[model samples]
Target: MFYLPALLISGVPLKEKIVLRKLTTLTMLLWLPLTAQAFCGFYVAKADTSLYNQASQVVIVRKEDKTVLSLMNDYQGDLKDFALVIPVPQVLQQGQIHIGDAKLFEHLDNFSAPRLVEYHDQDPCQPMVAYAMAPGSDAMTKYKSDRIADRKGLGVTVEAEYTVGEYDIVILSAKESDGLETWLTSNGYKIPPGASVALEPYIKQGLKFFVAKVNLAEQSKTQLKFLRPLQFAFESPKFMLPIRLGMINAKGPQELIVYALTEKGRVEANNYQTIKLPSNLDIPVFVKNEFSDFYKAMFDVQVNKHKLSAVFTEYFWNMGWCDPCAAEPLAPAELKQLGVFWLSPEQFSGAGLPVQITRMHLRYTADSFPEDLMFQETGDTQNFQGRYVLRHPWQGKPEQCEAAQTYFKQLHERHVQEAKTLAELTGWDLANIRQKMDLKDQSSTQTQDKQWWKSLW
Candidate 1:
């Protein structure tokens, strides 16, 4: 249960037709263009965060040191026991905190999730070719108590506190990690073991802690069944997320999907290796129905292959529109609600929002990620997604024309090739894929056209 994970992300995209090419690489993962100016296909399906069991979602809207961050999670337990502590660069004032809508997170995830696209091969004799592209709330509490001295006068200052929505927010600054740990524990917040050790470096760096617990009365007043997301706006030079604290309480590796909204271009991890997930592989059409299972299996395989140390960029695109949107792009109004401070009313109506979106996914345990996640917005704005391809072979029969006969000969070869690629991508048994593809009885020479004469037109 990695329910204790911390994460952040948010972005926007609009569809624009651009040129594309058939990705022929064996197992290499690459981003697929959403709409092709020259060679694009209809975007069909997408792999969203719902595929993962214990994933956390975050949205980050940033311009320079200034950032608006929203945090959402599915805390199915008692709201009374839910508490969150995150390290920030500075103390947040009353105006900086907000409560956000959860639908904003869903919209971003749909727009940025890795997708599936299909292209039926045109008649082999066709003049040109085409390609395709694919793409929580908590209660509130009230704050009343004043600053109180702790054991040994350990310097833990309650810098600020506020009742925001259903949360009772407290900002703290501490001089020593042990004192901070003791103070939090004494106050009835369950400080996870080894948290003091993780808090040391942040305290030394002069960071402030933003703590929140549920306020039953405020929550009941909201009249919502679940917790809404918490948003905070701040300006700081550090572009990073505090994850070390999450490791203290998680039972296993935590999963995260980040939707980063930047004014200029894509965002990536600056401190860790940022790798793109394996994408744009040609697989059998059977995958369309089982995309979720396939994606999880493929992701698990890649995580093990990478030893779980790297972060992955799943999608990065400009947020004006989508070619064949898996879900509609978030409206400018929704973007503003998610804390896109720079977005203005004019931009929302005209050419859509100018903001770009970057979707990053990562999984880590305490052992794999020892430090917090650090990120930097990149100048690269090239479109990319964790996209899978399913080429529905042209169904023209051998009697159609000479091209049809030729196509059938090559189609078998392509089918065999597709099978092999699927096996490699998912590490599935070749025999099983062949069985599923109905290629179990075909011989090498026969498949290689030893019987080419049988199909001669």
Candidate 2:
């Protein structure tokens, strides 16, 4: 299935959606690397960014004021219809812009996605010795003389332009949002209604515009099935993402996942509350089959509970290793392609090279999120991930031995509690969860068996 890139700004033809289709969640069959065995549980499945529709993904590699921002656009339509208008702190030079590999994003997504891990039950009669597992770890475009004069009159300046990879990029500094909107509409970029309001804030902040459109001829040469990600590097004090522009033309609340790589520690939203998703919970084994559904439902519940105002920390850990890696740790070369400027090739293999990655997910509407995302890097290096657990019950019968009997009895209680936990997390009906587990609904059984006249005085 075709998946949409989430990193787009002012994408047009306004109706051409950057949509994501549902992917079959890979379950127990996924091979966990040998290194992952260091963790107490075995890696089973994951809920990656692909599970959501209409989602965007951004990678921010920042150290001090130096920053490299990469956007993956998931546009599904005619190549000619694709265009983007993003606000930048300054005009980017030709050397500063680049087209990046989509694989980088895929590797990062798999590495940091919320994961599902499992542990098998040891025989009740045998000593549990396996429990002691070790821990693992844009350039401006050139314009004609009359074009320059026309742009000047409209309070707009085409600072620079470049044809990088398959994109035709233009850098613009606008004096007013209205004039900028006019310039865009006049230049064949279909400006959605109410775009002026969205453009106003960036203009007021003295930010420049990085505009891009598909060069169909160049794109055809690549013979690629999807657009390659666009990347640019610059120095700026502002550590934020301009999402307001993307929302102006959106039909509904948009999903965004930001992967931030920093030297000191994890990154978080400065203006909004950065909450962590519920993780490390023991769930029913049946969830192994429907882990995708379980995650979506749980995410929906979290969004509602927070009123869609919170940014959720899905994963945060040092890049050197993962306790129960969803995928292998990224290689040093991959890190360089991702714009990790501070790390040298020699330092990539060293554990001392500080690279902390933070994965943040958000589901937001214009009403719930009134401002673009602003971020701050913190020194907190605590390792966290949105991980769920499933423990396979022992197959031995209750009558096999004394320990077996005890195990089955305790297992029943555990199953009941697991069902309750699932219900609470996903808002699924408790009775239905119990039925799916093939366990009796004790509540209903007690109700039906109780004497109706027990309350008689």
Candidate 3:
């Protein structure tokens, strides 16, 4: 017989989506460095001219000191009033900045988000064979110079300034946090309360500030409902992300999801704990209809269980392909679109570029996360996904034969175990979940009145 991988399944289009337009900025500050997808940073404030809110997504592709970073937020506020403050290890030139596709982030998110799959158990009464399965899966602003006298007076230098897409970009260097804060407010970018306190550290580290705001006129021309992602590329020895700035005035904890791609291996946090998200458990079939709600509730339980102090890797797999693909391996073109600078023309042989992707998530407050996210690409190449399972048992009646009776006995036992597993993972009441499972539908469950020898037929 011809052999095929039992896990082989056609690519399924993503059904659950977190609409980008539905997101709001709450007052999130973030920063990241270059290695693969090197650096990221942001600050959110309550004022009209500032970005505020939770849940930001970033993609970092890094190798050594070279990095390509993409920053995205769901800022539904007025474009004219929006502003971004990020940190950089070096000055960014006009060529180093570009506008990225928002759809790409959605695609990556869909492809990497936790997945739910189902299996049909063959009747154990019949002879059966089992087979093994396999699996897999920003631009800087420009600064202006002619205002040297004005900038100098504030002890800040506008390194470069130019229009990139819909953003007015400015790269700035300051001698002190106070001077930088003074320069930013004077230039129409509102520095949030206590910004100088947060800016002091990056300043002392000799990092430059990247400031970007949407130009309303340019934004109108794009004819898009949301801001396109911002791309930044540069070389630096650091492999980390800055999150302290985002915490400056945040009302509560913020969530960030990172899609890190590398040619070497999986990417994970170094300073904070990096552990795998729970996976491969048999859950109630009802989860199929409410996977999104199930995932969110499950994730919340996990966060609380860890006391909101850990980073969870949701998916980590080689990029060549997937067994049960959430979506197809991102095409080479898509990778390039997100700033995978290492894939040269000659490198695109019959074999695809050797890239590994790790999706990590965390929620942090000023107290829970005190330092920026530091990362290291690990040598571990094992493939993993946040996959949950639902197995539909054979429904044959126990009166059919002795095998059927035995199968029924097993089914009843399996249902009990499955309920226990679901309760363990989600904290839902086992009895409640069992009721929802509708055990009344099963003949095995209905046959509790039969004698033990009768169950053997």
> lDDT: which candidate is best?
2
TM-score of model number 3: 0.83
Worst 10 residues of 2 by lDDT: 36-45
Query: What lDDT is reached at residue 445 by model 1?
Result: 44
Error of 3 at 380 (Å): 0.7
Deviating ranges (above 4 Å) for candidate 2 = 1-53, 131-152, 443-457
Q: Flag regions of model 1 displaced more than 4 Å.
A: 1-53, 121-152, 348-353, 440-448, 451-457
lDDT of model 2 at position 401: 80
State the lDDT at 141 in candidate 1.
Answer: 21
Ranking by TM-score: 3, 2, 1
Residue 199 of model 1 has an lDDT of 86
Residue 102 local lDDT, model 3: 80
Clashing pairs in 2: 4-74, 5-73, 5-74, 6-56, 137-321, 140-160, 140-161, 141-160, 141-161
List the global CA lDDT of all models: 0.69, 0.73, 0.71
The TM-scores of all predictions, comma-separated, are 0.81, 0.82, 0.83
Minimal lDDT window, size 10, model 3: 18-27
Tell me, by TM-score, which candidate is best.
3
Q: Give lDDT for model 3.
A: 0.71
